[model samples]
Target chain A: MDDFKFPYFFNYPPYFTLQPVRDTREKQIQLWKELILKYCKHHKVFLINLEEEFPLFSNTSIDRRLTYESREVFLGALVSEGRAEWMDKGHKKCLILWRRIQDWADLILEFVHEYGLEEGVTTLEEIRTGDETQGTELAGIDRVVLVKALKLLEQRGKAAIFKGTSADDEGVKFSI
Target chain B: MRRRPGISGLQTAAATRDQYRSLGENVAKIRTDLMMEQLSIFRSQLEEFARKHKNDIRKSPAFRAQFHSMCAKIGVDPLASNKGFWAELLGIGDFYYELGVQIVNVCLSTRPHNGGLIDLEELRGLLSKQRRSSRDPITDDDCLRAISKLKALGSGFEVFSVGNRKLVRSVPTELNKDHNQILEIAQARGYVTSEEVQVSLMWHSGRVIDTLETLMKEGLAMVDDGHPDGIRRFWFPCVGSTSGAVEAGSELSS
Candidate 1:
């Protein structure tokens, strides 16, 4: 990562502090909103714990970390823009929807189609950890996000999740 | 012992300059070449005459009497008697050219400029007057209305001062510098002309200001720099000694 020297503005002090001035805040919010989404999409990061140190929230060299309030401000801005969401009321866990939740569900449907899994039944565990998804972006998917995408498909009556034994050992049947 | 808010026309001046220049060029183009040459010659001759009398006009008792009499008719203070050397070089040849003015106001005030308090009643009354025009017919009213709101809410605000008295903080103060905030927003939203102001207004009242500020900060709506053909480029918000960078630096340290 050091090889990719960040832009000069990365060193700008205010760039780390969440701006409160409306005009400045709008700009800072925009840059962060874009940067956060870009970073999450690249790393395939789903949950962002505001309590923990995320690389996007901390600049080690700068000795700066976004305060919890700043994180809420940025994430709250995203939620308002429909680009992200809070997983719970505590506001501690966030689901970074770099891509819209709808888009993610669409991607899952497309992936199922590409693998000729249309009308096929597969164990939920197999779909997540099996060799087919090993090298794909779907391999390390968050359980909540996967359930969400499956539920979206189910809403359209395209697929269904059935109980097997436990929560981890579930199965999905698709009707094409 | 007070500093007044910087004049509103930093943005307005940019527009007025372009407008005046374009009008000057158009007038020059429409007149015959011979007429232009003759006018130029007459102008030079007038300058020569003004220069010759510059010294005499200041020191000569006879000339001072006439000068003061002429100034009295126009209600201007008499030119200083000591106006010597440098005044001759500049020459007053353009005196008779007949400049036009859209608005002019003169008044006396007892209010202290740096009181950190703005008399809301005075500001509201001032903005509601016809003088608060944009000089562009379209958004002239909108600009006035915006100013009106700013006035009621407090236009040149400082921390609430000693009870009722308002202070006129230095123009560079962060809190008082927001008069140009609207311009900064407009620039960022890409409203390159007066026309864009109307379209952007469709979103929300705040939208116009947001775009204006963006432009000013990014130096897009800067006068004579971007969109030369457009009139919106005429207004600039950064005119005083303090600049966008200075404000940014102070904020950075904070």
Candidate 2:
């Protein structure tokens, strides 16, 4: 994460503020959207809690931080673009979809094909934290997001999700 | 002088006045014709000079500026017509025209950031960057000439000075003296608080806020309210680090 480089404008003081003019605000929002996505992806962060400290939203050197309104505005822009989603009605927490659900579903399918798991039945937890998924994008995956991706795969009739022997365990069978 | 008492004497006096008037008209016409001939000769010689050193004028900024000055002294606009000898021989007309178009593109591209106002030196840098494929290097003088030519299109393309910096304004919004003063104050640190402006400019808070708001509305200034002091800071990109270069060493090390 130390190798992650922020944009040059990240240090600019005014970048922390929400622009008032239409054109300027539009560009500002665009830059913020890009920075948010890149930052989350770099840190492997899937959630942004607006109430908590987000390092990208502040520059201590310049003594500037994005006000709550500006933070919400920028995150709201991402939500409207389908790059993120608000987790609560108050918009305090946001689920960052750095990679869209469709792409994640595709990656999951690719992973299954790479591991020759097309015909094998595996539990949902195994795909997420199993040894075969180590050092891969699927490691430490968010359950809800993974479920949504799996549901998308199921919709295409490529996979089946069903209960295992115990009520707590869920298994997925990939048809190909 | 004797007074004329009859119609014959009056007629002679009137004829003499008419003769003098005709002589003056003839002299004036001949003088104009001589000037036109001299001007035509100067034009041909200039054309010959341009044709001979066409590469120098195109390649060197200094030589190009000198050539433009000389043309100005003789009252010949080499960039007036795009189809004539000047354009055909030197392509100076097209040069500035191309520069003008590039200027507009640069301004438009940076407008989202700088709000249609840019430092002239930065503009030249961007223009040269955009013109990197061409052999010619443009000067500030060339930019001024091209921008002056752009004034004909009536889109508020003009250069003005604030403090020691020359700023090119592409927007039609006019900046009054107060706005200029605020900009000058902001130039030192890129951001100015209303209290500072009020103290330095000896202006009331109302005037300061009004002017700053105008700048904000015009996208010339952005406001920061996150400072520990809790005072609003107005940041002017046109006068600030918009043209700042990234320190390569620090970046590489980091």
Candidate 3:
């Protein structure tokens, strides 16, 4: 995370401003959208609270900060591109989807095939924090996103999600 | 001769006028033939020079410029057409045609960042970088000539002077004196303040805001509103410190 390098345009002062011109604004928004997704994926950050400080939104060297309206515009563009989603009606929080849900589902299937867990039953908690999932993309996945992906697999008859004896122990039974 | 004065004298006068007319016609034809012979000699000498120094003309921009001037003196346009004897003998027409294509590419690629107006020197720098594989350096003179050729497209590609600096405008944006003055002032720092423009140009706030806003609308200027001094700064990416900033940023990332 500390070794992450921003693009050259990060130092540009105008990048912090919402451009008034049509073509320039479009380019600026596209760059911002890409940088945001990259920064989020590198840090494993699934949530962006627009109310709080995000390092990518400002450059101290140039003394430039994105105004609140500008931040919404950039994030709005990301939402329209299906790369991000607003967490609230007020747009104070956003979910960064560096990897789309379908792609994540495909990764999970690959992981199951690699570990020979075709017909094994494993708890949701165990899948997230277990040694088998260590050092993989699924190790620190957000619970909400993981459940959605598991549901997609369930619809495809690849797995089943059932409640265990206790509510905390939800299990996933893989069919193949 | 005195006895036959009236009729014989009139006939003699008519005969003398006809003889003078024939002599004048002969002299005019001979002069024209000599002029044609001299022009042909000049053409042959030009062909000989071009054949002798074809490499110099192709490799060195200064040498090529000198050769162009020589052609101009003789009322010969080597770049006038791309398929005549000059094109076949010197390939100078294709040389300029290639340069024009590269120039347009650089302008189009950098237009998003520079808002379609770039400093002439900066344009040459970018042009050379793109043409590095060819090993032929481009000069300001060459750029001007190539750009002038672009005027036939009538697409608003032009070069103009502002505060002793030449700027190549790729768009049809009209910039008045106030806009030019602001661009000139921003060339020093890459950013300007309304206060600076007002004090330096001795204009009131209304005029300053109007001009700067027009630039903003055209995408030629970007506004920074987060300074601690609470003053809005308008930055011009087409002028001032662009290369230095790019180098510094690359150093940080690398």
Each prediction's TM-score versus the true structure? 0.42, 0.84, 0.86
Sort by DockQ, top down from the best: 3, 2, 1
Please tell me which model should have the higher DockQ, number 2 or number 3.
Answer: 3
Candidate 3 regions off by >4 Å?
A: A1-5, A20-23, A42-44, A113-141, A163-170, B1-25
Query: Candidate 1 lDDT, tens digit per residue, A1-176?
Result: 22232332343334565543455557667767887887788778889999898877766554456778888988998989988878999989899887776876787787789878889888877767888888877787877778888888899998999998785688998877
TM-scores for chain B, listed for all candidates? 0.18, 0.86, 0.87
lDDT by residue for model 2 over B1-254, one digit each (tens)? 98849999889999999999999999999999999999899778877889899999998999988888888887888888888888899888888898899899989888887888898988988777767886578889989989999999998898999999899999998999999999889889988999999899999989988999999989899887777877778888887755462333236328
Candidate 1 CAPRI-style tier: incorrect
- Judge the docking of candidate 3 as incorrect, acceptable, medium or high: acceptable
Give the per-residue lDDT of model 3 (tens digit) for B1-254. 45756887988999999999989989988998998998789778888888999989988988999988987887888888888888898888888888888889988987877789899998898888778886688899889888988888897899988787899999999999889999999988889999999999999999999999899888789877677788878889888545556665666656
lDDT of 3 at B68: 84
For the predicted complex of model 3, DockQ is: 0.47
What C-alpha lDDT, on a 0 to 100 scale, does residue B89 get in candidate 1?
Answer: 46
Fnat per predicted structure, each in turn: 0.00, 0.43, 0.41
If the candidates were sorted by their lDDT against the true structure, best first, what order would they fall in?
2, 3, 1
Model 1: DockQ against the native? 0.01
Q: Identify the candidate with maximal TM-score.
A: 3
| Candidate 2: segments with Cα more than 4 A from true spot | A1-5, A19-26, A109-120, A125-141, A164-169, B1-37, B132-134, B245-254
